[model samples]
Target: MRPTDIESLIGVGRPAISSDGAFAVFASSRPDLAADRTVGQLWRVDLAAGTPRRLTRGVHDRSPRLSPDDAVVAFLREDARGRAQIFVVDAGGGEPVQVTDQPGGVTDLAFSPEGGRLAFSARVPEPGRYGTVEGRDAAAEPPRRITGIRWHANGLGYLDRPAQLFVVDVPATDAEPFYPPAPALDEPRARVVAGPATQLTHGDADWSGVAWTADGAELLSVPDEIESRRRDLRDRVVAIAVDGGAQREVLGTTENLSIASVDVAPDGTVFALANDVGEGGVDFVAPGVALFAVEADGPRALTDAETIDLGEVGSHLTFDGDQVLVQDRARGRVRLLRVTRTGAVSEVLGGDLEVNGHAAAAGRVVASVASPESFGELVMVHGREMRALTSFGATARERGVVVPVEREVTGRDGYPVHGWVAVPEGEGPFPVVLQIHGGPYAAYGVHLFDETQVLVDAGYAVLYANPRGSAGYGRAHGRSIRGRMGTLDFADVMDFFDAVVADDPRLDGDRAGVMGGSYGGYLTAWIIAHDHRFAGAIVERGFLDPAAFPGSSDIGSFFGQEYVGTDPARIAAQSPMAVVDRVRTPTLVLHSERDLRCPLDQATRYYAALKSGGVEAEMLIFPGEDHELTRAGRPQHRVQRFDAVLEWWSRHLPVG
Candidate 1:
């Protein structure tokens, strides 16, 4: 897969099925190389017809949802100015009607059960800020008082503004749609879609994950409450009555475990995918998100602690009649699993594919699945069987994208390590790239990974492994490296890499290059510093200095303390920056200018250290990009980075 091939890559988001199980709607997107941005549209597939149909002409439509009556399709769309708002169209397909003209734009929206009202969430900036007439630009606004650490977030800069819940009544007739001018957001719960939508939430808090009860009498959402400022990813689910828009019932901490997402059954039973803490904070690795049923009686575990972890990344837990549906990750493949109140867990759809997401209604199910050779595609689930509902990635597959051949080897200890190698089409002696994944907790799974495919296309054998400290192998493996990032995890990585290189004659050990991002970037630096087997190394957005990382990164407070340690000596020992002088291999440091996850200082400091120490090194930074540069940054940036990487390798460790 060449860098430009990504322009044809397809991404299918989570599926939203209709109440009657007749059809499913999802947001399908792809990169527009000419525009340097992503273009998306809503699509619907009729179960009976077994075909997919385009439903919208939007350029960035997402979060496609069907009304309870299946007559309306609601989704979020970004306008010409890049501000998102809610839009609704007939299920049969027609011109969409804009429902909200929110200034900050809507982030999440859901249709009420009665189909007369829509509940959504949007950021509310101070009256004089965020493009308001009082202050067209943030620079012109009054000086803001800094108060909390969570005030800033990656991607969306300064998050001091509160995001509240709102309700808008859809026009009952086919009359012209009403879109009121946004009002000042000075008061709590002030509606951004003022005049048309009624405000439901207030205060300085942000509300998200909005859902409506079956009766449409109340709405449930997770609020970024006070405790969240001190506690990472902390949240409390609240139920608000729609009548008075005042009555609220707070569901406190779920048995001390933080909730990632929650879904309410028609009977008021709350099913959630929860984990240890910190929501998805980088440091909250190891423990898997378990399924829980929260009710008046108390919270009950519905997933087996010994072998269940419904990954919370996209696990939109939902009620499929008496059974609950979630995406569970085990042994690398993310499978859709169903659980009963009695703790009887069964796999609804399991295979070598990663079930990115799943949704079911009226006994019918649909999911977005990805394999080792595909990014994402839609599938219909029928009683443990899955059938292709879309051929989105057929082009890549037909182009002969190298599929990673899976392998497992025993580590230094008795632990068995798992990984994969995608060999380029060549004869013998292929230069190798050890691709490390970010998230000391994340694993290299049997999914189509762009990094592996891109490197392999350049005639380099890529070895990407999920050593210890990676997920999908269970919490034990993940927790092994907690507070010891460079210990067992590093050993496991080396052991697996060495084993694969020794067994595969196609791989050349001397010409090997180590490269990774985020945590992977850290490990790459760590590998080149401690072990001098590589001729070149590329560290992209690495977590270099732990002590300094606690404040600069968004998840600073909890990430470093939990993932590394409090001991100064241990932190120094594990940090690559602490031992930068030991590096011998020529290296390339790539970073994003606006990266809040790792920050640009990490790359700058490391590059300065390398140059000062007389090591052959270079640094490249992408403007206006964040930590997700490789995954979701601008298409142009991604292609440029790929080209830079290939050039770096060509100069240092050219393929034989």
Candidate 2:
């Protein structure tokens, strides 16, 4: 998918499921609207009727969640000030009641098992650097500084202040800030589940992908961090009980397991997907992906290792205490299957139902399914029957969209570099865009709702190749570029392009564009800085100065010591900024003003250098957005980003 067209189906964060499993809620763009202009709205569906319904009419609403009792839906909406606040709306559709009008925004949210209480994660605004009242509310004064985990931090990327879950009693009458006063330490009140939501773990532990047990007493989650030096995606599954104090890790990183989805069986057995540690570190474990279970004895591999490679990225593993529901996307299409405790896998539904996000409630599973519709439908599945609960599917499927061609390109080092190439619909020569994926750790795969389809539709051939250091290729392939920065990855992109252009004439070798975000951004900038063959380049949220990034970026450890080597001297040599003056190609610098991953400084420095060096360069900055702006920011900003990037290519590599 081109970046612009994928914007409409861009789904991130977590999906919400109704208590009764009748409807699912998700955020998606209106297909009828232009790329640079529409807002994401909450839509619902009648599982049996397969009819989608719009829940919110606002221009920008996101992270829609259903209350425990299913009467109210809580979500975050951007205000005029650009701060996101929590709001509650009746499921039956009406004016939403504002919950938090404060400046500091709310990030993560959840509803207590009982409708009596609402549990959510929020960041209370802190005063400016200089303020008279040290701990004052500052509500009476204009917000001097927007303080919180989601907001952008100056030197230190996005400081994801751990989302401490808070509980506020559902007021008998309408009330603002729906958040109740801090929970009393000594007394156990009915307000919000107290200590359980607080620091359940120690030492800046990141808690995400939270799934509640059927009884809500135990919670299963994946706490993960990428070990850069070792180049490992490490994660542990911990079980936390409401009455228990500290969480216990049942699954460790011994097997190179990065738990993506976990569903606890009625018997307390946790089912997850894991891989075996092979040669190239985590990369060598290609066949390690499989469905597994953990119980009193230990973890056991459930799925047959020979039958499938076990897809993990787009596929989610869920168990109903007995049967497991997995949305497998490894085979190019989304397939739903039921796995019994005996390890017998039966296909439930398999077609073009591209499931992006999913959740299981009681006896049914709710998922975000996209097809030809502009918006994704909240699909519900029960036993042998499947139906769409929401009618928000796209009005008409856009045809002639290019399907990516998946294959392998030989790396300069002789190893086959695996990647996907999307060609535009044309007979003659067409300009090409070398699209790089983020997550020097993440691999480019066949996942749905990707935003890179725009370039191909506009008559530009797109190539997304996973060079050395990308996950899913095996450890050695991923670690091949360690301590080498732009060496191996740079060669891979250039060589892959050579092969593609040699094989296809539609690809105009003379005019080419390079684009990527985060690590991809770094690669894009590095490409233009070191090589001038590209006609134009687009770098989004990528690092320029490796030295400055060590202490400033969120995952400093990712590139600082891991990929670029720990020594400051070595980092400087590998930095794109150190050699930016060499760049002569026209470049478009794009980043969220508040992006934490690469930070705005990375963009500004490169932009200034390009302009000062007499190079054609432009910077697109979205205000008050973090690293996820492209997928989760205000709808307008997302649209503008696509239009701007496309416009840059139009001006430089104009295709008639």
lDDT of candidates 1 onward, in order: 0.82, 0.65
- Look at candidate 1 and give me any clashing residue pairs: none
Model 2 C-alpha lDDT per residue in residues 18-99, reported as the tens digit of each score: 6666666666555323544446677766555555567888777888778767788888887766667677788767767666
All candidates: TM-score: 0.94, 0.71
In terms of TM-score, the best-performing candidate is 1
Among all windows of ten consecutive residues in candidate 1, which has the lowest summed lDDT? 186-195
Give the runs in model 1 whose Cα sits over 4 Å from its true position: 177-195, 226-233, 278-283
lDDT of 2 at 15: 64
TM-score of 2: 0.71
The C-alpha local distance difference test score for the whole of candidate 1 amounts to 0.82
